[model samples]
Target: MTDGSIQQTRLPTRTVVLHIGRHKTGSSSIQATLRHNQAQLLQRGVLVPKNLPPNLSGFFSHVFSRAPEALKFNVERGHGRQQAQKHGNRLLERLAHELEAFTGNRIVLSGEEACALHPDEVAQVRDRLGPVLAPAGQQVDFRVLLYTRDPVAYASSAMQQNIKKNVKLLEDHKPVVLRKAPGWYQRTHAAWAGVFGADAVEFRSFETACAAPGGLIGDFLTAAGIPPEGIEPQRANDSIADEIAGFLSSSHVPKLPPDQRGLWSAGFDLSTADQEILFAIRGSKGGLLTASEQAGLWDAVAADMRFIEREFGITYGAAQTAGAVPFGPVFMDDLKAALPRLSPPVRRGLLAYLRDRSAPGDPGQLQPEGI
Candidate 1:
C-alpha cells in the first residue's frame, strides 16, 4: 500500500479556463486584455500562457480540425500530414510543460477555434490533458466558457471576417461556402459538454456579457474564477466593412489592368497606416442588405436559435441586427463618395479597376457570393 504521505503530496487541483469563443463575441478583445495584463494576472494566480506556438489562435484548428492539411499555414508552405502531426505533438508537449512549470492555480487558454472543434476532436484534447497530468499526480478542473451570438449576426460577422483574409488568387468573390445557418449549436456544444461534463461548460450570452461590469473580459474572467480587478479591457476589430469585402470579390478585380490587377493575386501584410486607411472604406450607415435576404437567413438559423433559447435561455439579439450585404450597384456609389478621403495610389488603383469593369452591356454589375 502507498504511504498516506504520497497521497498528501499530490498537487492541488489546477483550474484551466478554456475560452472557446463562438467568434465575433469580443474574443479578440478578451484575448488582447488577457495577454496585455499577463504580468498582473500572474501575480493573482491566473496565467495566460506565455510559451506556446506563435499563433495560438489557430492551435485548435491545427490539431483538432477535420482538415488540417488544408490550413493556410500548412498549404501556403506546402506542409502536409507529417508536419501537422509534429506540430500537434509539439503543442501538447508545450502545454504539459507549461502546466508543470506554472506557479498559478488557474490557466486561461483563449482561442475561438476551440469552439469549432468536432466531438471526437474535443475528446482527443480532453484525453491528452488527463494523461499529461497523470505522471505528476496533478488533478485538473476545466471551466469551458463560450459566448453565443444571435445566429444571424454571427453569420454576418463571420463572413466579413473571412473576406478580410481572402486574396483574389485563393478565392473568388464569394465566401468559400456561406454558412446557411449559425454553428451547429446543439451538436457541437453538446459534444464539448459531454467531453468535459455539462457543469464545466458554460455557454453564456454574448449580449448579456457585453452589458456586464467590465463587459466581456469581466464576465469571462469571473466565469473563469479569475479576479477581475485591475485588468483593463481591450478591443481588437480587424474586419473590413462588408461593402469593401463585397468590392474585393466583385467582378471589378478581374477588370483591373495587369499592373493594378495583380494586387489581388497575392496576400501581404498591410502597414498600420495602410490598414487604417483601408478601414476608412466604410459601408452604408443605413446598412445595405435587403430585408428578403435577412428573412431567408433567419429562417435557416431559427432552429439553432430556438434550441439555445430552450436549453440555455440564450437570446442572441435579433436577426435584423446584422447580415452580410453583398455588393449592389449602390456600393460603387459609396466608394466614389469616399474617394476624396483615400490616398492617391489607392484611389488610382480603384479607379482603374472600375474603368474596365463598367461596360455598356453590364452597367455596374456585381457578382459577390451569397446573393
Candidate 2:
C-alpha cells in the first residue's frame, strides 16, 4: 500500500535514535547489543552505523573537522560551549552526509559521552540533528534513555570501576553515606528533557534491566520496542572482579603513587584470584558491609526507586517479579573459574603490564634489560 523509493522504504530518512547514556548503568550492555545486532537491525529496515566509531573521539573528530575552533576552548579551558552554534551546524552537516552515504535501512548513532552535554549543549545537539534529518524527509525523534540504580549500590559499583580505570574522586575521602541530593541523572536527564520533551526521554533502573532472565540486552530491547529474540548476547565490558579490585586498591585503601594505582582505581584485566584477594583485603579493613548497613543501603535504594518511578513514569518491578537475578554470584563464579588458569608468571606479567601502562612516560625505560 506504500509507494516510496526503496531508499526511503528501507531506510528511515527522518527518525534517528540517540541513546545518551547516563553512566554506571547498563550503557555498556546497550552499546554492545547495538553493535552485535547491526545487521539484524538493517534487515528490520533500521541502520545502526558501525562506521560511526566509538566514544567521543570519532564524534569530536567529526565535529572539530568541520569547525576546528570548537575544540579550542574545550581543550584549553575545559569549556565545551566555546563555539556552540558553529559546532552544531558543522555536526549537522557531517551527520547528514554520512546518513546519505549509508546504504543500510536505518541509521543509529550511539555514544554514552553524549550524556555529558549541558542544557545549552543539548539544544545545540537538537538543532544540529534537526537539519541533518530534515533533508532525508525523516522526522527526527531524539530518545534519551537513562538507567539509574540504587545510589548506594551505584556508588559502590562506580568506586570499583574508578579503581580499575585509575580515576580518583574527592568523595573517596568521605565516609560512604547515602545522601539524598540530586545526582547526574537529575542534572543530565532534566537538561535533555527540557529541550526534547519528557515523552521522548525514557529512564529505567539498571538493577531491573540486569535482573531480567534474558539480562540487560533483553530488557533494553523490550524498552526500545525492538524484538529481543535472535539478537546475539555479547559479553558485557568491564568485569566485576576487576571493578572490585580496582575500588579496594584505589580509594578504600591507602593511596599509592599514580603509576601504581589502577586507572579508575579499578584495576584492569584482574583475574578471579585478584577479586578474592580484594574481598579478603576489604574484610580485613572492615570495609565489607555490615548487615545493618546493607539493609539501610537497600532502604535508601528503595527511596530512589520510588523517586525515579514518579519522575520518569516508567516501571521497574516487572523484571524483578520475573525471577530477578543478582550480578554478585556471576562475578564470584568468574573469579573462581579464572584462578586455576593463572600461573604465577602470568600473574606477574599482568601486574607488570598494568604498572607499565599506568606509569608515566615510556614504561620501557623502567623495563629490565631482558624485558
Considering every candidate listed, which one attains the maximal TM-score? 1
Off by over 4 Å in 1: 1-10, 53-55, 65-67, 133-135, 167-183, 252-275, 281-289, 317-345, 348-371
**Model 1 lDDT vs. the true structure?**
0.66
Reference-based lDDT, residue 10, model 2: 51
lDDT of 2 by residue, 307-348 (tens): 577886544331111111122344435434443555564445
Clashing pairs in 1: none
Q: Mark the regions of model 2 whose C-alpha exceeds 4 Å error after superposition.
A: 1-13, 56-94, 103-106, 134-137, 169-183, 242-306, 313-371
* Tens-digit lDDT track of model 1 for 3-116: 898887878887877888877888888888888888898889877777763226677777667677777777767889789767777877777777676676777888887877
For all predictions, the C-alpha RMSD in Å is 6.6, 10.6
Model 1 residue 161 distance off true place after TM-score fit, in angstroms: 1.6
